[model samples]
Target: MMKTTSIIASLLILSATTFAQSWTVDKVHSRLGYGVTHMGISESEGSFKDYTAKITSSKEDFSDAVVELTANVASINTENEQRDGHLKSPDFFDAAKYPTLTFKSTSFKKVGDKQYKVTGDLTLHGVTKPVTLDVVLNGTTTNPMSKKTVAGFKITGTIKRADFGVAAGMPTAMLGDEVAIRANTEFIKD
Candidate 1:
């Protein structure tokens, strides 16, 4: 009886781990982006080129996925070298003080065949906030070069920049307080 019990327990544990698949971020194909109001009418867009994320999915399907990501605050770029320098100053992101931003998913639920809701805690500038992202699973495909099983996903959300100590010009209550955040990531089974 003892031997049978031990065998069953080991099998259960093995199945639990096998039922999930792990993936690493393909940084070359992934992008982190944000948009905010520039001067009341125009919008400013920027992308972070340096970031890393890990994900685990049940059966290698994104519908049952969990993910965590970390981004370097100093990697922010808006295509303008001058503005990029300003963003790293005290007037904006202040990358020198806080060098990293992180996100960890708490839950992932399927809303449709191609859509999902990912709820996570985002840490920025030392502040952490709970956020829910609308995600679209762009489907799975094989890479021509690597010939590996890859999944694509797009997630978008909004957060109050001021809450993370990014309030440079948000002195009054009239201007927008939230910034649109988005990310596109491709993951490969590891």
Candidate 2:
């Protein structure tokens, strides 16, 4: 009886570990970008230079994946020093008060082939709201140099700055209320 129990316990442990897989972002190959209309004429683009993201899943297709991300608000870079500084001020993200913005997925549902709808709670500027983003699995492959399994994903969505009280007082004419998000990320299995 004791030997049989030990064998069963070992199998259970092996199965549990085998099923749950974790992946970490390959930061060098990833980008978290955003865009906003400027003066109703052109678009201004920016990106957070510092952030961390992870993916956890138990299924091969990633149908049961959970994603989490955190970005430093002070790392906003628009290529212009003055604009970047202004964005970190109270008029926008208020980086001093709210140093980080985060997202935790509530659901990751496969909508079609290699496509999914990810719904999550986004916390920014001291406010939290549910936002849905569209995600496409670009591809998955084994890296020749690293010999590690990697997955590529593209995510796109829009969120209203007012919804998170970011630049609440700014007029839509000067800076569009809607902010467009585009993220291309590569995750390597651990």
Candidate 3:
């Protein structure tokens, strides 16, 4: 009877694994971006040129998924030349000092059929902090261009820029200490 029970347990575990869906970001349709108040009247927009993301989800539920992201700090892009240079300098991101920004999932809970609250540790500019993202699972579909099954999601939230050791000069009249960030990505099965 013990041997029979062990065999049944093994079968259940295998079945659970088989039903899970795992995917990696499809760079062509994925985007990582952020917006910050500039001069208190305007907003500054920027995005990282290089990033990698992965998702391991169970088609059965949103709570049964893991999300991860890694971004290259040097990939920061804003339109201007001088400002971008300054941002990359020691006064701000100091990309030379910290080359990568990473995030690993700590929890993923469902808020709706396609909405989720994802909490994780975000490490940026040499600082690590917990952050929560309001994520919307845009559902899954087949991409004609890539000829692959893909899942899309829109993840957004804000983090205190200062908390990430990115606090430089925040001119209240121009820019503030808080920054708004948004990331949208589509993951494809590997």
Best by lDDT: 2
Q: lDDT (CA) for every model shown?
A: 0.85, 0.96, 0.85
Candidate 3, overall lDDT? Answer: 0.85
In model 2, where do residues sit more than 4 Å from their true spots?
Answer: 1-17
**Ranking 2 against 3 by lDDT, winner:** 2
How should the candidates be ordered by lDDT, best one leading?
2, 3, 1
Query: After aligning candidate 1 to the native by TM-score, how far in Å is the CA of 142 from where it should be?
Result: 0.8
Query: Per-residue CA lDDT of candidate 1, range 1-190, in tens?
Result: 9999999999998997888889998988899899887657777889887888999987555666788999998999999999898887877877998898999999898898888899999998878989888999898889999999898889898888878778556552434567888889898888
Question: TM-score: which candidate is best?
Answer: 2
| Candidate 3 C-alpha error for residue 132, in Å | 0.5
lDDT of 3 at 123: 96
CA RMSD, predictions in order? 2.0, 2.7, 1.8
The stretch of ten residues in a row with the least summed lDDT in candidate 3 is 167-176
